[model samples]
Target: MRFPRTARLAPPAPAAAGDVLAEAERLHVRLGAREVLRGVDVTARAGEVLALVGPNGAGKSTLLAALAADLRAGAGVVRVHGRPAADWTAPELALRRAVLPQSTALSFPFTVEEVVRMGRAPWAGAAGTDDEAAVAGAMAATEVAEFAARPFSALSGGERARVAFARVLAQHAPLLLLDEPTAALDLRHQELVLRVCRERARAGDAVVVVLHDLGLAAAYAHRVAVLSAGRVAADGPPAEVFTGELLSDVYRQPVEVLAHPRTGAVLVAPRRDP
Candidate 1:
């Protein structure tokens, strides 16, 4: 799996819909003695939501971190915007991508608005940046504007998750790497978050998200990459990749993949009846 190496710091051409924003080619990553990813290949494309789905220990988060340049790939390469991820400086990477980790914990007491505004720091002193509008718009979109002044430390788990997501939206980067954005949300907020992901993709941003919920991945993701034992078991549209046999085998449980009676949306659930 040899890849042509692009020059460091080369100017990337203007990206459009269907363009690849980030990708992992023959990527392998190790954490201490444990190899988390092995020979994995995946891509995040503009105007699409690509979801990483698998059971625990499937290397989903490790792959996302590698693509974000937070983790070094031991064997292969991670490319972002036409160059190796290692070539980009932290500030440069911040301008091109925004990341949301699984945990949204703030040690200090900061207001919701203040926490959201922290996302704009990367754009400060840059010409033509409307900080206030970005902040307000993000808050409104995440439905957190009403509690803008409340302390982040005082918010509930779900509220904190939404506020953290508002911060990512405020960053306004072309690529978004989100790890379990819907894990802490209720039904309505979960739907809201996926809707926003779809909106971002429709607006020509590339979104890569790690989702534990198979139903959510089936319902909202434009494509699904099903991982198993540190490799991609299958990757394709939900209707194609999410068959019961594959999912059941990957998850190590008897599972059922069904379609909604009216809307024909894909549905996944563990098999309970003997």
Candidate 2:
């Protein structure tokens, strides 16, 4: 289906709590001895949504991992809640941050609610303080409550995405880190998930999402950080960073930057349909 005719508007920054959710300090990352990121500096503050956009293998996912404190930097720092990530206890960190990787693996057959509730595991501790009300609220907010009891694997791709997002919301963290969150879903589901992310940021959470869809990135993110060849190519407002020259330089393909007629947001399209 064609994209729903949305008036390309950047909603005002949602009402949020105090700012300062996360920071990256000259961060560098490597995986299995392969250098993935180089001298990357980034930050996410409450009340705003940040989207990371890049060509394939541009280290988008690596940067997300570093910001989430999943990957240790070789020479820089990742601070969560204004403190070095390593200093926070695992449970404490989990309580204040949440991450949704590109995919989830569930071997056991459990209802959708079960997988989402697992996000609360970080806070539940041994005695399992996972409040039932919190779980229900998260599910409801993510629009997964309708299928809470359905088997996860049995659900469609979009349904599973909603459930996964519901799980992250259950963590109730002030910071959210997501990787390729809308890669597989249709346009409708993509909008649904992005809306949920926007809702959380409006509620005072700091949000950083990795996205391949530049159009969605433009529409939803307050800022867009473009990465190329393991370094930040450009980082600023979408219209400023998504220039015709920058887009061509980063992707090595001619592209057009169109100003949306309604929201005034910038939309990127390939110069050649191919």
Candidate 3:
């Protein structure tokens, strides 16, 4: 679909470090009378996993929507595959990227397999066998195969989360946008979800996942982008971005960030003021 003249497109860019894959450059978005994103800049190199974090109403989801081009940013750029996000047609964009919004609601009693197969709809004339294979592979990866024949509406919240993730995997887009993929997952499934995200990055897909768990972001993100009040508070490797001062300032609470004993990854936890 063609956007109007008022739309903001990215300034011509030569990829920074010659490695940018997908990004938002000074992107801004407003909702009705309220501004949700205030000129956010983000970048993810090929095969990198970017963890997005912020308090509720901080615009983490809004930023994700802009990145996926589902929501237009008011006055900045969102680029995918080195081009303005608007440059791609719907079908082209679908083949190039996939987004899993936080709330995916379907009142109909669709089977889990049916839901996953919907991801393959982006492609034209994709064989049923091929679609089924993709569906099966995704279900297996998420360990949700047992529920494939079950109705999505009948599954528990976490079960539905996993099944939805399986759909994104089936999409096989080079870029992925996930909002709270582990919101209701058990510990084991949470780890599995992160592993699947990491494995996707390893295979050259760029991933941006919204996460509320600071510890998980520190442990899994190739980089973390912390948003506070609609702007990027810190963007860097976890150790640098999740610092005590940064966290305390952004979160408005006392906190501590220490290096993990084994992996040297940064660890964060709340600390009392006294």
Model 2 lDDT per residue over 163-195, tens place: 888888887777899998888788887998888
Candidate 2: how large is its RMSD?
8.8
The lDDT for every candidate, in the order shown, is 0.91, 0.82, 0.84
Candidate 1 regions exceeding 4 Å error are 1-14
Model 3: lDDT of residue 222: 89
Cα error of candidate 2 at position 45, Å = 0.7
Q: What would the TM-scores of all predictions be?
A: 0.94, 0.88, 0.89
Model 1 C-alpha RMSD vs. true structure (Å) is: 6.1
Cα lDDT for residue 267, candidate 2: 86
- Candidate 3 has its poorest 10 consecutive residues by lDDT at 1-10
Candidate 2: global Cα-lDDT? 0.82
Flag the better candidate by TM-score, 1 or 2.
1
Q: Please give, for residues 1-274, the per-residue lDDT of candidate 1 as tens digits.
A: 1113332332234579999999999999999999889999999999999999998999999999998999999999999887899999987888888999998887898899999998876776666668899999999999999999899999999999999999999998889999999999999999999999999999999999999999999999999999998999999999999999999899999999998999989999999995
Least lDDT summed over 10 consecutive residues: which range in candidate 2?
1-10
